[model samples]
Target: MKYSIRKLALAGVALTLVAAACGDDGGSSTKAGGTTTVATSTGSGTGSSTTVKNTASDTGVTETTIKVAIHGADLSGLVKAGAIKGVPEDASVGNSRRIQYYLDQWNAAGGINGRKFESVQITWDPADPKSYQTSCQKIIDAKVFMVLSAGGGFPPDSTPCITVDGKTQYMGIDAVSAKQFKDQLGNFIGLAPPGSASAKAGMEILAKDATLKTAKVAVLRSDWDFANEAFTEVDKVAKAAGINFVYSDAIKVANLPTADANKNVALTVEKVKASGATSVISMLNFTNFTVFPTEATKAGLTLKYNILEISSGMCTSFSAGQLPPEMNGASCVTHWNNFRLDNTGAKATDTPFEAQCRKDFEATYAAVDSVGKGYPAITKTNPGVPYPGFKDGTGTQLDMDQSYYECNIMNVVKAGITGAGGNLTKKTFQEAIYKVGLFDVAGIAGGKGSLSANKLWLASNVQQVAVTVNPDGFKAGKDANGLYQGKCLSPLACFRTVPNTVTPLTFTLS
Candidate 1:
């Protein structure tokens, strides 16, 4: 079994049709980058034990292969035209290369349970939503076991034949978030560290600083669904510490002209200033956030603290540049991880770990015989259009984006394979994944693994925050391994290392 070049997919056990069995209840969304859970939703079983055939002759060894798909993100044509940088249309080589690197590693390691890993890279236009179904049909044609991180399945006009067997799943690099997916459909788990998690983490950070805790905050966002829920938690935590939460709004825009969008941003700046807001938590995408700080600076607003979510910072298109000195020192949160580089600092480091993954990713790419093959330096910023800097450091530094997230996917897949106890087929691997705490892919391809699954012990296994900028004088874009130890302008100038991190807050819906 070999990997497919056209689809950018690895091989899997041949697919077979199975009658629907039983499934779980409606999907759930949580605060953290939402983690999705997939369950069998075939037959209706109520508290009855369903029989899982362990015998190979439950009739033929019904081979199963899980097919994972990633459609290149759709950005405005301007992005490809070099009017803007950082979109799938003109992504940096390092970005897709990292992802391909990991996929190759999976295949070389004998794939999942000796079943080769298969992936597909589809390019589509968002104007045509029907593309989602067309791509889905292709996977169905292949009779793949399941879809991973896939969207643009077919033309938006018709979502036909999206289901594969009784189990069909979909996810993507950054767009199809865990919470958003669960909100739209049922029975598929999306794992993008939920918005709730980021919101809460960001809030806890602000709460740690007394200067920030006492200042008023305006929870601003374009979408209230997840942002509101996240800020609700932030408000709750801030109130517990007696912080003054001044004002918040959905920033309703019926027909936002460029000026109107800028005005809305100005409104936020004015509101924050009027209310004496020391910190602003804007749950905005890069496109919208691009307007915020500019307006705030124009209004001569001085924020004591500020935090932008993943979109504003990680994604290159809308996050960077043009902010005034007030924000030159602000911090942003993201699920995208940069490959760990230097561990050297005033404190401890993970340089060794970073080196290992970098080596593996590089080696994996070299071994692959493909047209897109190329060596990517760990420091080479993600390949998006125009090629933006990772974050503002003394100079440009290497950072991860979709590439890093996908790399982690590769890591987890290896973990899942190892968890299978050397049983890598799609059919047998599920048992190892669902049951084992961590999947260890130790024996395959002679890579290390005594490697256990990095599965978050609980849903709260949210990735911690790192500072990209510091008014206190720390550099931005370096792998911030020290938490908040570098030279910062002020305590608040540096990132507030949130409490309860070593001990994650338990998620209890009370």
Candidate 2:
């Protein structure tokens, strides 16, 4: 059954996004004698005068300003040298820039519930696990109202930790991570693929496809604790769906550049073939994904693979014709529509919502050059063309996801403030979030946003897609040139949602 938060809440259960027996301990409060500055609106609406206040008692929230922090890999430097993998470096940098854009726009449009939004920037090395802890600690010290750790996929700072209380605490690590983060930091939100549920969704798709219905399936994912947890949950659902799970192996590889990376890929492929598995479910990065088929081809092995498409990690690479032909019919489990370059026609018939979204995308894309070269395809060629590049443009699903993540958080912040009314404390703000449950953000991948009362996460809504090779070559979907033509971008694909529901707390924690 699809777990509905409204149903549960209506039933009188006080469950939070993270089901815990503990109460908020105010662990994120500022240290004694430490002071933080907050921005607030002195008046109301767009013309309201903004004011800043520095006080010891008030950590993040103030009369005029609400302070937050964003932690992620040093994308600004990485994208400039063309060193980042998976999504384009421009997209990575664009994600951060998009966050800033959202804040500025919100302030311009009267700000969040009359108070402006501000953020502390902390860019850590992606490969350094300690950086995450240090960054979160910094946010805690700063007493930001919320923390958005916008790593490409998964929190770079999250890992299993033994708390001072001697309990096994997972902060931003797994299902319990959000709670742990909230316990240590203030309010927090993140965008991570519901891997196991998505895997089950993919299995349902396979069950319907004649070619893969009875194929011997193998599960391949990173050997991280979180990935393992996802694999375990998926294994249960796949078995329930009558999937022939012939093999399961976790790839214990890091996303860094190392000699063992290629070796690990070769070894993983060997394991898959030796198990006689005909199909694979991969929950790894795009770089590792490309390595899988490449190694398979070199070994003369034939196989089909399905991968998780989230965080703009897989779509851009795939849509850019980066995959091999042998993997033509490979499937992807995604919650959002993949982005395609569009240059069709310019029309104003789109709903105000869409035009606004596209406008936001343009604003962010235009500013990409402010940090560095921006996207090589976009700004480097035709400058100031709203949608730049080969008209490859900036309004793809990847860009939208960044906007969605931040905007949704902003929505929560606004809702919390409005709900709190005259008394907007951290506790009241949280209460406001729960009171204003099931928010539908204007433009998400699925067109509808689902949030639970009091929960800081979105319910899993996944769909499966099979790569439809385009013999006519990938065409940039026509941008608004007066009329829009064609459906879906080049490298055509077909998708069907799996008739499945993942209940909250459904995945096993152990």
Candidate 3:
């Protein structure tokens, strides 16, 4: 289940694309007594105006620097303890390196308003819930103005320690509930679409699909706030579509120990089987893909799967042998476009920005490897090919997901700083980010990225894809670790985009 941590983090970042031209206030401004005051539009599409005062005394800001804390999960300890699986030993290192690379570049380019960014790197063990709060407290104690979480394992409960109590801006590249965002008082910014939007879109897709619409669906969700919010949206979509769910329940042991969580999932499988449901719509995280399918198979239950969130990792899990045979033909409604799929046409191709990001990452990794860091270097024969399934010399693939996420989030930070103008206060940063309208994002499909005061989420659209195993076997050779490398081969799979299923998210604040 701890594998869900990394998957959720990657899903949040990879699914989001935010870029836009900065809009103007068109009003006068003045500065006095260590305060900068400006008149700006409210950006609520209501033609309203307000005065915003940005003080130099704001926390974490000094004459020559703006302090930020970058938080990530150090899963190495858990992996070595045999408590977690399928996570790289250098996961935290990779994330920190990418973020630091961007910060260095920005600082070298004369950072926001001549104030260079000063970041404090922080890490926590995922197996320890107390560590999450400790990480948050560390950032608060550091007196950073902003907390930029690079990956998952930052529990929702710990977030308020920074955003609410500490009064700092929190930008997370992970999924969270719509309520969480609202409760933050405009302090929390998520890179991915909220769980409500993702769940609603999944149900909408099921309603529109000819075959899935008539199926008796069972809704399964975890007890997490984000999953519960998703379940609520699912219910709304089902009611509006005039579709009835055969069964619906939350896994009660979501926050419990592994044994209790497994027991809960097993019992849920029994209930789902008894409900006479032919399909299941999952509102949980990546754990659903790993645990639920295996449990269902054990009970001899055969159900069509439709996952609402973390679909990127879920789709690939089938190929990696992480999921049971019950998930062979599962479908996912997600913002991710699987570049490993064969028949995706232009969608599988990388944009110019994505290509450049890969080049930059490769160069960075090469530099690190030169210093005997033991990190995998980009060894792909073709520079144009996507790195989803490419195996490195260590038999592990370069984490393109993390790379893309780091790139996108850094771009968003830069945009926010640039849009904030000379007054780099939390208020100005939030307003600036909200006013940055649609722009091109590297990994996202064209015209699918936007942000506004009303629309805090970055992703604009979602697509459904089917996970299917490829018929052809592995390509010619093997990696240094004896793992086969190549295109979608036998045990390896592909997430083919379902035709005519691309849907835009309804940009409404719930």
lDDT against the true structure, per candidate, is 0.40, 0.46, 0.61
RMSD of each: 11.6, 10.2, 8.4
Residue pairs that clash (backbone atoms under 3 angstroms), model 3: none
TM-score of 3: 0.78
* TM-scores of all candidate predictions against the true structure: 0.59, 0.67, 0.78
- Two-way lDDT contest, 1 vs 2, winner: 2
What lDDT score goes with residue 126 in model 3?
A: 59
Q: Which model is ahead, 2 or 3, in terms of TM-score?
A: 3
Q: By the lDDT metric, which is better: model 1 or model 3? A: 3
Top lDDT model: 3
* Candidate 2 Cα RMSD after full superposition onto the native fold (Å): 10.2
lDDT of 1 at 200: 66
Write candidate 2's Cα lDDT for 345-376 as tens digits: 11113235444554655556554453335443
lDDT (tens digit, per residue) of candidate 1 on 1-510: 221232323333233433212212122222121111224445775333332321111111122333555444344443544333433343423244555666666667645444454666544433333444445446555444434442111221122133222233333333222344333232132233345555665567567777766567776665434455566666677788777778777775322433455456666677677876667766665444556666776788766535535322332212332233455445444333232211123321223444455455444334322212232333332322112223334544423322223443455545554444322234334445455443222111111112112222112332333333334333343335423234321111222222223324333221
Residue 30 displacement (Å), model 1: 41
